[model samples]
Target chain A: MQSKISISNLDFYYGKTQALFDISMEIPERQVVAFIGPSGCGKSTFLRTLNRMNDTIPIARAEGVVKIDGENIYAPGTDVVALRRKVGMVFQKSNPFPKSIFENVAYGIRINGLHKNKADLQERVEKALRDAALLNEVKDRLNSSAFGLSGGQQQRLCIARALAVQPEVILMDEPASALDPIATQKIEELVVELKKQYSIVIVTHNMQQASRVSDKTAFFMLGKLIEFNPTQKMFTNPDERLTEDYITGRFG
Target chain B: MENRLLDQQLDLLRDKILLLGGTTEAALHRAMQSLTERDSELAKKVMDEDRIIDQMELEIDRLSVEILALQKPAAHDLRFVISVAKITPILERIADHAGSIAEAAIKINQEPQLKNYIDMPLMAEIAAEMLRTALDAFTSEDAAVSREVILRDQKIDECYHRVFDELIRIMINNPQAATCAAHLMFVAKHLERIGDYVKDICELNVYLREAAFIKHSPNQ
Candidate 1:
C-alpha cells in the first residue's frame, strides 16, 4: 500500500485570491481516489497542482510540496514536461485532435518517442486504445476523423491519448460530465479497470459516480479539504457534518 | 431541500407505519384482554382482525418499494425506507403472535379455568407498552427511547419464564390441569414472542436514528 502521490499543506492562489488552503492528502498506488465537492471548491485546482498544470495560468500560484514516489515535484529545476508525462490528465470536455482516430492516439506516442518502428507505434496506439476500452468500437474506423465519434467515444479517445504516454497516474477532471448515462457508465467501468496498472485521481461532481468508481473519497468544501475516508464509509457515514450534509443532499 | 417529493413520501411512510403500529398494538391488547377475561367473542374478533394487519403490511411494503424504485433515497432516507420495509414484516409477525394468543385464549375458554391469569397479563402489558414506545421512538427519531424499549424486553422475558414455571408446576401437581396449563403456556410463549418482535422494532429504531446497530441485549 505505497502512496503514489502525497500533498502536504498545499495552498493555491489565483492572483491575490486564495483558492485552496492547507490541503493535504495521500493517494495510494493502484487505487482510484475521488475528489468530490461543489463547483469552485478547488478540487480541480488541486488536481492541476499535482502535475503543475497550473503553470500555464499566468496568475496562478501554488505553494508546498506535492510528491510522487517521494520526489518533491515542486522543487526547483524539476522538469514539468516530464512530470506531466508521468501524470497525465483528461478534461471535462473531450478535446480530441481533429486528426484521424489512429493519429489522435498515435500523436502522444510519436511525440514521446515511446516506440521504435511504424509497426511498433501502431501496436502502442492499439494497446492504448484497448486499455481505454475504445479499440473495438473504432478499430475499423481508425482512419476516420476523431470528431466523427460520439461524445463518449471521443472522451475514451482522449483517455487513450493519455494512456499512450504510459503515465503512472491519470487525473480526470469530471471526465464523464459531458456524456450521457450509458456513456458515463462506460467511463466509470474503464476507471475501475485502469486502476490495476495506474493510480487514478478523479474530480467528480456526481456523488454516485464517485461511490461507484473510487476506492477512497475526499470531500472538499469552499477550497478546504473537509473529510477523507474509504468511499463506502464516507458515503454511508461521514465523519464531518458538512460532508454528511452534502452527500445527503441537505446542502451543497 | 433536494427532494421535496421524497421528503413528503417519507413523511407519509412514517405516518403509515405508525398507523400500522397502532393497529397491531390494539390487537395485542385486545388479545390479552380476551385471554384474561375468557371473552370468546373478543378472542374471535382479535383473530379476524389479523387480516387487516396483513393487508397493512403489504401496503407498507408496496410504498417502500415505490420509494426505493422512484427516489433512490440515500443516507438517512435510504435507512428509513429500509427500516420501514424491515419493520413491516416484524409488525405483521407481531400481529400473527397476537392472533395465536387469541386462538389459545378461545381454546382455553372452552375448558375449566386452571389458575387466575396474573403474570401472562403483566407480560402482555409490558410487551404492548414496549411496542408503543418503540413506535414513538421511531416517529421522534429517539434512540434513547429505543434503547429503553430494548432494555424493557427482559421484563417480558422474565414474566414469560415465571409463567412457564408456574404452569409446569401446576400441570405436575395436578394431572387434570395439563390441557389448560399447556394452553396457558402457549399464551405466555406468544406474549414472549411479541416482546421479541418489539425488540426487533426497537433495533430498527436505533438503526433509523443513529445509523448504528445495537447488538447487546437490554441487560448486556
Candidate 2:
C-alpha cells in the first residue's frame, strides 16, 4: 500500500472561478483508483491536475502541492514533458494518429528516443501492444491503418500508445464510455491487468465500472472531494451520506 | 436524480416479502392453536395451507432474481434484495416446520389426551412473537429491534428444555403413554427449530439495516 502520488491542500481555478476545493488523498502504487461523480463535478478536472495536464489552458491556476514519487510535480522549474512521459493519459475518444497501428504505438518511443535501434523500436511497439491486450487481435494487421480497427481495438491501440512510453502512472478519462458492452469489458479487463505494473487513475461516469475495476474510489461533487474509500466499502456501505446517495442514484 | 422505475419495482418486492412473512406467521399460529385445542380438522387445514406458503416463496424468489438481473440494484437496494431472497427460503422452511407440528398434533390427538399443554403453548407463543417482531424490524429496517428479537430466542430454548424434561418424566412414569409422549416431544422440537429459524431471520434483518453480519459473531 505504498503511495505513488500525494496531493495536499490542492485547489484549482479556471480564470476567476474556482473549480476544485482543497483536496488531498494518497494514490497507492500499482493500484487502480477510480474518480466518480456526476457531470461538472470536477472529477475530470482533478484528474488532469495529477500530471499538470491543465497547464495547456492559459487561464488555469493551481495551488498547493501535487507530489509524485516524493518530488513535487507543481514546483517551479519542474520538467513538464518528463512528468507527462512518466504519467501518460488516454482520452474518452480513441484519437489514433491516422498512421499504421505499429507507428501509432511507436510514436511515443520515437519522440522520446527510448529505443536503441530500429529492431528495438519494433520490439518496444510489439511489447506495448502485448501489454495493452491488443497484440493478439492486431498482430496480423500491424501495418494497416489505425482507423481500420474496431472501436474497442482502436481504444486499446490508444492504450498501447500510452503504454509504449512505459509510464509509471496512467490516467484515463472515461476510456470505455464510447465502446459497446463487449468492448467495455475488454477495456475493463485490461485496466485490471495493467494495475499490476502501473498505478492507474480513471474517471468514469459508470458506477459499475468504478466498482468493477478500482481498488479505491474517490467521490467528487461541486468541485469538492467528498469521500475517498475502498471501492467495496464505497459501493456497499459508504461512510458519507452524499457518497451513498450518488452511488444509489438519489442525488439531485 | 430520482429513479421512479427502480423505486416502484423495489416497492413491489417489499410488498411481496411482507405478504410472505404474514402468511408464514399465520401458519405458525394456526398450527399451534390446532395442537393446544386438540382440533384434528384445524391441524389438517394447517397442513393443506402449506402449499400456499410454498407458492409465495417461489414468487418472491422470482421477483428477487428479476430485480437482481434487470435493475442491478446497488448499495441499500442490493442488500435489501439479497436479504429478501435469503429470508424467503427460511420463512418457507419455518412454515414446513409448522406443518410438521400440525402432523404431530393430529397423531397425538388420535390417542388419549396428553397432560395439560402448558410449556408447549408458551414456547409457541414466544416463537410467534419473535417472528412477528423480526418481521416488523425488517419492515422498519430497525437493527435495535432485530437484536432484541434475537435475544428472545433464548426464552424459547429454555421452554424447550423444560418441556423435554417434563415429557421424558411422563413417558417413564407411564410406559403406555410413550406413544403420545414421543409425539409431544416432536412438537416441542419443532417449536425449538422454529426458534432457530426466527433467529436467522433476525440476523438477516440486522444485516439489512446495518450492513453487518452478526450471525457467528455474537459480540457484533
What is the Å distance of residue A145 in model 1 from its true position? 2.2
For model 2 chain A, the run of ten residues with the poorest summed lDDT: A243-252
Docking class of 2: medium
Model 1, span B1-220: residue lDDT tens: 5667888899999889988999999999999889889999999999999999999998899999999898777777888999999999999999999999999999999988876875887888898889988888888989888888888888998998899889989889989889989989988888888888888888888888777877674442
Candidate 1 lDDT tens digits, A1-252:
899999999999999999999999999999999999989899999999999999999999998889999999999999998999999999999999979999999998888889999999999999999999999999999999999999999999999999999999999999999999999999999999999999999999999899999999999989999999999788766778888778877773
Docking class of 1: acceptable
Which residue pairs collide, candidate 2?
none
Best by TM-score: 2
* Predicted structure with the largest lDDT when compared to the true one: 2
Off by over 4 Å in 1: B216-220
Alpha carbon RMSD to native, model 2: 1.1
Report every candidate's CA lDDT. 0.91, 0.94
